[model samples]
Target: MSQRERGTRRVVRSVAAATATLAAAGGTLLACAFAAPGAGDGRPVAGPGPCVPGRCPAAYPDPHGGAVVGRDNGVNVFVGGDFAVRGAAAGAEGRVVVEGEFDLAKGSGSPPAYHVGAVGVGSRVPPDNGSPFLRVGGDLKLAAGQRLLAEDGPVNGTVAFAGRQTGTGTVSPKAVRDTGALAAFDGLREELTAASTCYAYDKGVPRKPTGTAVNQGKVTVFTGDGTSAFQVFNAPFDLVAPDGSAQSLSFRKIPANATVLVNVTDENGEARTINTSAVALAGVRRERLLWNIPDAKVVRIAGGGQLQGSVLVGRRSSTTRLSVAAVNGRVFTAGSLAHESGTGGAGGQTIHAYPFVGVLPECGTGPTPDGGHTDTGEPVPFPTGVLPPGFPGLEGLEGLEGLMGRPGAAGPDDAAPAEGRELPREGPPMRASMAVGATLMAVGAALALAVLFRTRSGPGSGPGRRT
Candidate 1:
């Protein structure tokens, strides 16, 4: 062939080869984008409330990074909140991790008892076919062998998913009048504290709320009125900057016999109360750096006691805190300790009471010193309209205790021997380790792609071969 003609043929061959390479790479990228399964659309998705109608099954990003939800097969829509699961429309199975403060709104006047907050479900209906599930508010955690639970007790604002909830660990209130889960939560605390290690579950077992979705039935929050209802800690307490008042002392100096009260009020004049008594104190009070929200201050008191509190306000206002009174400790209250900005979005304002010794108080059964209230050996909500600030509504490190106080050990049974009252159940067993199979598969697929595109010359080809 002529030199010019040979060069032209080579150029054409090169162009054809490059085109083939481009097409193969393009096709592979497209397949990965669609064929490979993703946890969910990396965007904010919502789910149907219990009373709402639609195909039902749906999945949304958990406000907390816990579980995922959706329908399976084509029937049964489920809502997974905290440790339990509830029914929804369609055929769907949802996994939820109820954490933080879930606010419960109630009827103002006429329909006095209607609940209007996120509630925990007991059993979850698995999805049929291979359809995806629906999640609301937060993410769903896959706890392998963990059994879901519907913690229906006095302290109503947490959903936990770890191990199965055995009858021995289920938290229960002593009387219908009590509004805290300290009674039923005793066993769970022993299990956790005994381990000396804890992870944050948006919905811990003790304070699981009632009702599913936002209609039909609702979780009730008692503002210390005619009958005290349940009040879950919607947010952590921000006690960094005190109002500079005598009431705001270091949590350590808080009289051992004194009870701490955290009053959470929303913009609508609606208030929820969370109180825990200093049955026992642990550790020494320490004033450490808590947090600093844009429009708020933060403080923390170090001690140990019956930690209890609630979260109120809007989505941005939910936080957490700890309230405790110890013998040698001084209570240091923070003012305007609510919202703060942090890395990804914002950090929650919270109060930490640490370094004191704990002693379980004789929270005998019957009425409180204030009367009409049960004496669970903790603090009793009073008639004072003046609520305490820096009490709750802030976010912080997981594995920490509640804003009102750290969970205490369960006391011995006080009720008389009744016939056949089954004991509370413990939580499901936790996985020995997280599932990394999906991640490994993705890595392997990427490696295969790399090898496929790699160019190599056969052994017979010396320097460069001409095809």
Candidate 2:
């Protein structure tokens, strides 16, 4: 071949080599970019207060991350706060959404935590086959055995974390940064607290007789008037017996399908601790009963009992030593939460997801020192007249976290339990190791350039050949 033709061939080779090198680098960066982060779940964005046909909308509209995240298809736990897992694998009976940090285990070498499921838990009928069961709005700290379980076996594709993920914990379908499922539960927090206060409000319906709460040691008997819509009862003391065992609650003549609200408060209306056992209900059902802890800041459930009603915490709440104590209804805390899970006994207790279907009456805000009215603010309705800003409305709320001052918000750092070490933004040293691929690409490009240089301008008929 002529020298000129050889030079043209050399130029073509060099151009190809350079293009290949750049493509390799670009590919590496593309892979990292895709792996970086986005809203995890591929679900469509949703507006607030979306309704399903047969189910009644919960009085407490659980939050979605700027959109309708999940239906009220029995979301067992909505932590407008955060929690951590330890010991044996802790699981939720229904969908669980945490608007804060969720750690698989406490920390490195602490205790291994695993999640095994694809569908939502704790429902009577079959769960919707595709929605994620567990969603974390903040960072996700993965452990060794975080299996996304299915009916056939352990599978993947249902868990989504919005923030950083750490450790080499085995998460099927490979864990990502976010699922776009977030919440702003602040307004919902205020609404729930206000609703609790309304239920306990002293200036009840006109001429309606007050239900009597007679404490009889281990069991408290609440005798109601014949009214069936809203049965208001006042417990001058805590729900537990002095000894704390077999502390049961019994209702009399509450009329069938009556929405029952039992306000167990401190005599002086001060901050205190109320330990409620897994209560037994005689006349009322779990979905219709509400135990409004309007004053207590800390709530502890008995070790082996299940409390059979929704707990409307009017104060900032936390489930202290929450092992084996199952709540049969929704847990709408007024503030942040520090949860304890994975330690339930053989029977295994968890927050059972039963929506509150109660119709409550409005009173004059609260009870004054003399049984009159303390005009705090407007009366928050039970089946609220107008939905509050965050209480499941049409407005599109952004983000997954319902930060400080919301019902269960302790703080941002309260993502994991206090004991564990905080994982970094990017997990394990594997990311740093990705640079090795770039290095290899650079070397290949250099070799290609050398061959092109030699062929085009060295010992060939090219005029640009250098000595």
Q: Which candidate has the top score in TM-score?
A: 2
Model 2: what TM-score?
0.54
Most accurate candidate by lDDT: 2
The sequence of per-residue lDDT tens digits that candidate 2 reaches over residues 1-467 is 75433443443443344335434444332322333111121111111111121232334332111322233433445554565564442344445566677666533433343433322334322123444556678876656654433221332336667887776565554455555656422233334444455455432321233588887887778888877577877775766677754466678878888878777664333343344444657668677787676545455544456677766655434333344455666565544444444333433344644555565553312111111111222111121112223333212211111111122212211122235533234433335323433443443344344434444443421111212
Off by over 4 Å in 1: 1-356, 366-467
lDDT score for residue 451 of model 2: 38
**Candidate 2 residue-wise lDDT at 186:** 24
**Runs of candidate 2 exceeding 4 Å displacement:** 1-74, 86-89, 106-122, 125-127, 143-157, 167-176, 183-186, 202-209, 267-278, 317-321, 338-347, 362-467
lDDT score of model 2? Answer: 0.44
State each candidate's clash count: 137, 24
lDDT of the structure predicted as candidate 1: 0.20
